[model samples]
Target: MGETTQHFVLLLLCLSGLVHSSAAFVFWTAVVDISYYNNITNDTEENFCECGVYGQNARVETTSGIVVLPRDDPKGCHPDTVYNWTSSPWIALVKRGSCNFSEKIIAAVEQGASGVVVYNADGTGNSTSHMSHPEAAGVVAIMIGNIQGMEIVKLVNNGTDVYMTIDVGSPHGPWITSYWLYFLSLAFFIVTTASIAYFVFISANRLYNLRMHKRSERKLRSEAKKAIGRLQVRNLKRDDEITNSEAHMCAVCIEAYKVGDVVTVLTCDHIFHKACIEPWLLERRTCPMCKCDILKALGVEEESKDSITTTLPQDATVITVAGGDSLFEVPLTEPVRSDPERQQHRYDNRAFEGDTEGRE
Candidate 1:
């Protein structure tokens, strides 16, 4: 989870950086000059910083005097705002608002205005923003603060001609526009949030499965204990054995049963030393010789079908417990009965009944 969060933060930062670099504003410098008192007032002059240039307006050069548009044009586009190719190049000055920036720039374009200057709305300070006028390609456009635009507007309205100059200025900031900043912030936030959410969901699922697996193991162990309890147990005796003809070994340890040797017998009539088979049955609940689940055979409720990972014969020593494919088959034989009625069951015990039936 920590690693995931770190990666998300890095990705978000990269996105923010991309938006900041790609969406930048170009700064423009406007030199305003006004002839006052017939050049006797030293000709008032001021330099103003301009911002918010359209992409098409970047790096544009304008070397003409300025012209202010009529205040009450029907299209908010004064006839004077348009430039004539035959005349000297001119820059048109206009107030902001009453329509979109694109519309205003388009109106100026029809009149041949080589460049456009839009001032801020009434009483708004000189703060400026970038202009996106897709239709105003090939035209230079810049915005000046309201205070500066109004000062220039007053001089032009009073019939005082103001000479203007527009030029590319110094580069600025890592964050060029507010809209880009907002957009990047929003995108970063969304991606990071989603990544975190997914991480949490996966973690929760794994924990849930782990708990369920442990619970299942416990239930399997409990059922096996009950099944093992129902199996038959006996002690072999030397005196009860018939004259030595052949020897039989315990299937589990490959050792011969002796007097006082305790052993267990499964329902399938397979026998194994008690200590050996008891542990195995308590875990698996299946006969080692035939792979039959004693629990299910006895009609006990089960969680599911047998889920052992390995396939092996049940209730027999033929199956290797060490995770190998090798099998060792035990020899089948007939039982020697000292008595008739129960003699049949004695044969399956792999030896004559010994130790007087039940001394242990």
Candidate 2:
């Protein structure tokens, strides 16, 4: 039993990890404003695909913040070197390196950056790696592909003042569905083989037990039959009230209990139809007249004292809230019921607060 439980726990952990990891690996895109360093006065700023360009140079601004670089060198900071970001509160533009994208973001954050915009450090074209900063609290980070990064790097190399507004969306990575399938297959194989082996071991142990103590086995079987018979008798006695409750009528709706309809058989064995008691419980979990284990029937151990009131019966048309557990009651009059379509339209327009209240 303990070994079986351990295997179940292992299966659950693997399944949970697979789900979270797969969700994290979905494709994500980042949108940001790119300013070229060469064309400072022209301000030919535009949105570019982060994955499309290399060596991208970009700046981020808060309502009030300053750009600080490592070495306290305010000017001529090389965006390509990851070492340059250890200085101050400036946007650290780093080139893509062999390190994971997360590692680059951490390096920049360590230097006290308000945000980090990682562009392609390489010459040109698109590139992506799983680069994210683990401790990036209140700091934004973006990874643009090589091509776009390079254009920004050029603008910076030309001494252009680059600034950007970045909007980061979802994470991008490999599909983990196959890994999930693999995990499930492995779990199935383990469980199947374990079950077969366990069955064989149990059969062998039982055979040994029977051979060693045949008389004891006969006595045990006889005692087990007597215990089971006693349990059946006790259960039969307890079921007498339920059998006798067939004639009870719901006090609230004044309707006779229907056969095959589920009933909230009370502790007192006073059976009430489920539909009749459902609204009553929603308003109050206690039995309508005799307050008893109504909530227990609903599987609720604790309940608030507040009882929700059911809408007073309307002629018959009711609007149901989508996905909501409660049923709404709307009265339908004869004139409105004559044309079902018109009645429904009126109900929709009224409930939705649309124009054409009475003008329909």
Candidate 3:
């Protein structure tokens, strides 16, 4: 399996084990009720109290019988210990210590005892503990406090016919105990921390990608500026065909060229007013007439050779007008200006002059 799947499986197994262990630790209380004849008062007295807890491996059910104590040993430690009671149903009352709880329960079960009640050691008072008697399965066994057990023993020894009933009570463990709140709080904390951490990771990744995209756009715009500087610029004269023809107009500004007009020739052989097209090229990096990428055409940016073909006709030629003379020739294949400061100055002057004339 993959590493993530393995970790999930391991976590599930651990949780399952924890639940099983917690269940094992859980124990049920026993509602112990006793009735006897009060000889001095000449009346029957009964007492009911939830003062006992069932053993881990004992049967959690109701059982009633006369309370009987072992004749030889109160702890029921000896395997041969016997009971003197001749009743049809009886529950053995044993003391703590001297032997394991399983042994005491087993001794009582072998002697026809319907149930077993084990009391805690001395000085423990009314506080009882959950008992474990794995070896004595299927027997109804519970543990009562020393004080309660001693009271029942005294009544039985005084020749009073004391009848006891043990009933299953409520279950108690980590889920219902004081630890429950702490466990729930810990789980909530873990879930909240994981959610916050995942959200932060996603947000950081998106921010990083956005920053990278903006940086790339700025770099491409810078490259487009460099490519625009290398394009050819010419000053139009009155004798030029473009200045005389009404059909020829700059795409940007949508006006026919005039005498002394400065224009930039694009790689696609389409020309536009230098002032209008420079800003357009810097922002869009493409010819307005044919939508051709100037950066790719001028080799300033990398693109496939097959995709760089311009839309201009095969017979197209560059036009240059100087001193009222028009000359048709192949477009400039070399860089127009090599020095950065000279190129920037020339481009700025030509754009300023063109703008000034357009306004008038």
Cα lDDT tens digits, model 2, 49-83, are 43421112222222112222334321213333333
Q: Compose the digit string of candidate 3's lDDT tens values, residues 175-199.
A: 5443453454456568879999999
Q: What TM value does model 2 have? A: 0.32
Q: Write the per-residue lDDT of candidate 1 for residues 174-208, one digit (tens) a residue.
A: 54344554565567779879999999999999898
In candidate 1, stretches whose alpha carbon ends up further than 4 angstroms from where it belongs are 1-180, 239-247, 304-360
Q: Could you tell me which 10 consecutive residues in candidate 1 have the lowest summed lDDT?
A: 315-324
RMSD of 3: 16.4
Name the candidate that leads on TM-score: 3
Residue 243's lDDT within candidate 2 is 29
Q: For model 2, what is the alpha-carbon lDDT of residue 195?
A: 100
User: Which clashing pairs does model 3 show?
Assistant: none
TM-score of each: 0.40, 0.32, 0.45
